[model samples]
Target: MENNQEGILLTSAEQSYLWTTYQADTMAVCVFNHFLQHIKDNEIKSLIVFALQLSEEHANFIREIFIKEKIQIPQGFTESDVNLHAERLFSDVFYLNYIKNMAKGGLVTYGRVLQNVYRKDILSFFSACLSQSIELNSRAIDISLKKGLAIRPPTIPYLEKLEFVHKQSFILEGLGRREALTGTEVTNLFANIQTNYIGTSLATAFSQVCKTKKAQNFFKRGKEIALKHIEVFSSYLKMSSLPVPGTYEQMVTQSKDAPYSDKLMMFHFSLMIYSGVGNYGLSTAETQRSDLVADYTRLNAEILKYSEDGANIMIAEKWLEQPPLAANRRDLAKG
Candidate 1:
């Protein structure tokens, strides 16, 4: 047997976490492959293909590790599990948002894995995955901006000069307190900016895919909520002198005959909500200042509600994962 010291031995909790991540990665690969078949944009397709390959590789790696440790691998979703036809029924806009949201979730997952891992090899692997995820997200963001699938936020000019002068009782400030945003505040603003973009993209995609008056109305309301948040975040970015993210200029669609299915659209939206929650959690933890904390906390709560709504939609659509629930306390006690 390989030495436990040489190969990392995960605790039960760690195993559970790894299992969750593995399942998410597997789902991502399946979603990307479906997107690959329908996507016509070469750059976006290439990025999605690359991301799929990475996710597959990571899944294999985890499986190998679990095998080596004599631990049962979690029964996660596989290529055989996903309904490709159902996914393909969605519009290309929905696919783009799906992939982007998955990539965002990957960023958070890898970051958490990096923090939890202690073994050198495991840490290095997670770190590499984290970097790759970030790159993928950046590329997706770029594609979304170019295709006008995302909305851009405002930005402030970079400081080119700084001067400090002090008198007996007076001081000169280059920018007013209201005009400059602190670094910590800027980070929170950026987090919210990304969240808004994801939310809007999902709403727009859902509206197009569902093609029903009620569904479209639901999506329109979602878009309005995201727009309000975008404005709030943009104000912060403008005050801080930071660049805003790109905005959507045109709607994305696949062939009229192959409009996205409602199930696929809702699944993608659910994924985005989970990603947004993860990002908000990270931002809340990362920001230490009181004002920034308050902002992130409020944002986090709003996202929680959005996530709940998405979950309800998924349940109505029967697209959510059905994990086994414990029967009763007596059953558990007997075990």
Candidate 2:
């Protein structure tokens, strides 16, 4: 246990938060640099500039803490991980959506991390992160709306009257017997579909630009999985005669230049996979429908498998960075 002047040690939760946050911020810095290289839209460029500044600040803050604590700072994504000369791979609209989507993840992450952190400075850092993420999301959404690019979640009919379900069948789904989707289920389905839409396009672009055969195959498989999940999610909406979110594959350009290194792209995919799993877990926990729960569970398993394979690839390439670990008493005994 490390003791500072305050006599408090950094707990597992705090360390984990800081370690993972450092990685994510560094990756963001790399991608933002690439975006800045080719972004022509002044407004979108402004958002990128703000996002890059935040990520750089976060990485530097973590670096100082690690230095003071005598911990090894993570070699997160760097200049070598991005190619500024590569052609633009995505549209201006995607840059906005990417920022908005990533900001949502930041809000979720910072909020969760904030709850588990208690040190005054750590607490303040995460609180600021939450505020910044919210502002980022707000800014991106405002710009998206201005450009008519915001794909707002679908709205269901207003409740005419409150009602209660008296039968267990309300939780069950089957041929000719499934009840209409509830508001929560509708929201989850719509949000997941849109996320898959983004994933589908990302996978496609990665497939086109990934450097190696193994990575290309992995990304192609990811695109297939994302498309299948989108179909599965959209089916539930169709069953109830509701609208589904549209795909964004056209948002990707025809450029095959590898804007990001294979290591960076693989890490980015892992982050997306983890986020998707968390989303599915939340959706499963919140939904009352048995069928939806089963599908979320099954699909999450497939994604986990894909994520594991991605991990193996990263490990093989020496691109996977280990996190801070607790002391091993057995190893200490050997020493």
By lDDT, the best candidate is 2
- Each prediction's TM-score versus the true structure: 0.66, 0.95
Q: Write the per-residue lDDT of candidate 2 for residues 157-197, one digit (tens) a residue.
A: 88899988777677765523556888899999998998888
Of candidate 2, the 10-residue stretch with the lowest lDDT total is 1-10
Q: Which stretches of candidate 1 lie over 4 Å from their true place?
A: 1-9, 64-105, 119-125, 134-177, 210-221, 238-246, 254-267, 281-295, 312-335
After superposition, candidate 2 runs with Cα above 4 Å error: 1-6, 174-176
Candidate 1's displacement at residue 230, Å, is 1.2
Judging by TM-score against the true structure, name the best candidate.
2
Q: Find the number of clashing residue pairs for candidate 1.
A: 15
How high is the CA lDDT of each candidate model? 0.64, 0.88
TM-score of 2: 0.95
Enumerate residue pairs that collide in model 2.
none
